[model samples]
Each structure stands twice: as C-alpha cells, then as structure tokens.
Target: MTEEKGSMLQSVIHPTAIIDPQAKIGPNVKIGPYAVIGPNVTIGEGTEIMSHVTIDGWTTIGEYCRFFPCASIGSEPQDLKFTGEKSFVIIGDRSIFREYVTVSRATGEGEETRIGNDCLFQASTHIAHNCIVGNNVIMSNCAGLAGHVIVEDRVVIGGIAGVHQFVKLGRNCMIGGLAKVVQDIPPFVIADGQPARCVGLNSVGLSRAGVSEEVRRELKKAFRLLYRSGLNLRQAIAEMEQELDSSEEVEHFLRFLRNADRGICRGTKE
Candidate 1:
C-alpha cells in the first residue's frame, strides 16, 4: 500500500471499525463501532457511519450524509440475473438513512443506483437496484422501492408504501401510507390505497414549495381536464394546450402526461 493509503486519519473511527486500506475517507468523517467499509467505498467529508453499518461494493457517498445503525448500502443486487458484474451506488450530500435502510447496487455492469441531495429515508426503507431518487424526497418508515423506479424531486412516500418496478413518480407528488403503487404518478398529485389511485392535487406540497397561486389555479384546471372531464389522455393534453395559459409548471405537467410510459395512475373512482 502507498503511504497515503496506509496513513488514514484515525481520530474519528472507533477501535472496532474495519475500514479497508483502499477506502477513501474524507476529513471529519465519523465511523462508529463495528462499521465495515469496503475497499472500493469513498465517503465524503463530515459523513457519519454508525455502529454495525456496512458500506460495500463501489459506493460513493457525498458530504455530510449520515447512516444510522445497521444501515446497509452498496450491497449486491438481489436480482437472479446478477452474475457478479461490477456496479455502483452514488449518493449526494446531506442525505440520511435511518436504521436498517438498505440501498442495493445496480444489476448491469457499469450501471448505478443514484440518489440526490437532502433526501430522508426512514427506518427499514429499501431502495432496490437501479433506482434513481431525486432531491428533497422523503420516504417514511418501511417504504420500499422496487428495482428501476424513478422518483422525482420533492416527492413524499408514506409509511409502508410499496412502489412497483419501472414506475415513475413525478415531482412534488405524495403517496399515502400503505399504498401499492403500480403505475406512474403525475406531478403535484396525491395518491393512496392499494394499487394506488389518484385522489386530488397536492396543494399543500405545492404551497410549501413556493408555487404561486396563479400557477396552482392553472394546475387545478389542468387536473380537472385530465381526471374529471372524462377525456382520455391525448384529448386532455389537447384541451390543456388549447385552454390553459402557458406556464413552466403547466408545460411540465403536460410533458409528464405525454411521457407516461407505464401509464398514469387512474382516478380514485375510475
């Protein structure tokens, strides 16, 4: 080992911690007892790994991230087709993983599971292989995301919710507790129940995100056209383009609706 690899700063790591010599640990990082850091792991400045946490594989963790006890990150994928191919898990800054949260690496070679900044994953949350999670997202306790899910910014996933693989959740959307999400959820919506049906707009979420009243009203109009007008997807898009005033928010909504590959979630009564 080179002198740099052999001379890791040991002040913050507990005596029982086992960090590979090749692991790159930045300044002010704190590692607690019995934590295992793999050779290919890179932890950024001010990150904290608590007791019994295991960070393995080719993982890159950003600055100020915190992992509570028993959290496991960058583990091999659980897919049956995994054949020991190299993959990665990349996380952004200031995220928190609560006790027993697990983030798995992607299945294909050179692929990665990526998470954005300022996300909070509560206890026992599971992010399966190849998921892409956006910034400021919140996953309540026991929420589980299947492989290949795409979660956009500022979304809230309630406790015990289970998202199906390949589903896309749009920005600022909210999913209620125990929801079983099987399809795409459009932007700024609220969905709940088994099989996850859309119920209403996420007014509170939009307000918290500093969306203006004018934009919110336009969004409401768009929502009515999409859900209550009894129009199909293409027809609703046409109506929105023709009737609703142009705004960045409304245009994003139309684009999301247009690109809903797995199909958008249906209305509650539909």
Candidate 2:
C-alpha cells in the first residue's frame, strides 16, 4: 500500500487566486480557483482548499482535511461587543467542512475557537465563536451551534437543529431533526422536540456502535425509573442507584443528569 499523497500546493493553486506570501502552507496542500489564504493562516500538509474559500487571520488547519466551495473560515466573531480581540480558529486533522459552512473565530481577547478531528459539518452549518467541538461529531445541514456551546465526541446533531448558547451535548447523544435544544443533553440518549425532550435510549446508534445488549438492558431500566416512574428527580436517582446494577456508562448518565444546569429534557409521553 503506497502512502496516499495529496495535490501539491504550487501545482494545485489557481493563477487567479490571492495568497499572502507570509502564509505558511505545507506540501500537498491544494488551493482552488479564486480562493484566498491570508497572511496569518497556516495550512497543514494534505489539506485541500476548495474554490472560493476564504481562510483568514489566525487560523490553523490540520492535515488531510477538505473544505468545500465558499466555506468562510476564521472570520471575526458575530459578537457586537467584540473590540478586535486577538483570537483564533483551530481545526484538527481529517475533518470536512462542506459548502457554505461558517466557523467563526474566537470571541474574547486571547481566546480560541476549536474543532476536533474527523468531524463532519454539513452544508450551511455554523459554529459560533468560543464553541468547542469534539472528535467524530456530525452536524447536519443547517445545524447551528451558538457561542460557547460544547459538543462531545461521537455525537450526532440532526439537521436544522439550533443549539442554544452555553448548552453542552454529551457523548453518543442524538438530536432529532428540526429540534430546538435549549438545555443540556445527557450521554447515550435521543433528544427531540420543538424544545427538545429526551425520548429514549439511542438504541439504533448504540447497537450500531457495538454496545453490548446487557448494557442496553440496564439503560432501558434506568430510563424507566427516571422517566416512567412517578418518582421525582431525587427519588429517581435513588431508585436507579438501588435497583440497577452499577456500570460506568450508567454512572456517567446519572452524573450528567445531576449536573444539568440548563435542565434535562422530558421523557417520551405515554
């Protein structure tokens, strides 16, 4: 197996493009027609800069990533109170930013906006400044994350979902399409609604990811205690502790629920 190499920078750059001589571009980095790479930009090896894309000040892009047409990265944050802060946008390796996606630079002085590796942002997705995204995450078309939101690893945010500011979505969680998530979503569950409610365990996702059946069984019981039973929040927690067998996954779920500052979603209505 030969090592996969990308298109060379000089060979791939279009003659009509404008790139700053001070920009740091690595080997096998492709810049498409009419693209713009600013002086403060540093593009890593094997990254492809597609047509009409603009990568501006203080942006660092890792290797082997692809940016689709018209993706505007490293633009100033949308915060009105911003006073030209010295901020940056950092994108990790192997991520894909689709057409028309917008990832803003960090909001405050000396801060940074971060995106993790191997994630996919579909067309028209917007990640606001100061947002933190984790690895292997998927943000569907038109999905948006407000400023300071935290999206954990392996999470799938459905199309057209609008996540409120300061919300934290836990690992392996799934948000249904068109949902408005204004609260913190716990790990390993499905959240869906106009205001987003916890429907149930993410069975399809968990099974596809090779989670054990025994673990799924325990999760089901925990869901029943927390959602189905008439017990209040504290009572539900107590019941889960006493009735279900303890496991790391279960404990993590409980801890997430307990720490929800914005509150958790409601379970499915019977």
Candidate topping lDDT: 1
lDDT of 1 by residue, 1-270 (tens): 111223355438887898898899987788888999999999998898999999999999999999999999999998998899999999999999999999999999999999999999999999999999999999999999999999999999999999999999999999999999999999999999998999999999999999999999999999899899999999999999999999888989999999999999999654
TM-score of each: 0.96, 0.91
Which residue runs of candidate 2 sit more than 4 Å off their true CA positions?
1-11
Q: What is candidate 2's lDDT per residue for 1-270, written digit by digit as tens?
A: 112123233436767678887788888777888999999999988899889999996999999999999999999999986789789999999999999999999988889899999999999999999999999999999999999998988899999999999899987899999999998987888999999998988988888877788888998888888778977777888888888888887888888878888876677762
Error of 1 at 198 (Å): 0.4
* Residue pairs of candidate 2 with colliding backbone atoms: none
TM-score of 1: 0.96
Candidate 1, residue 261: lDDT:
96
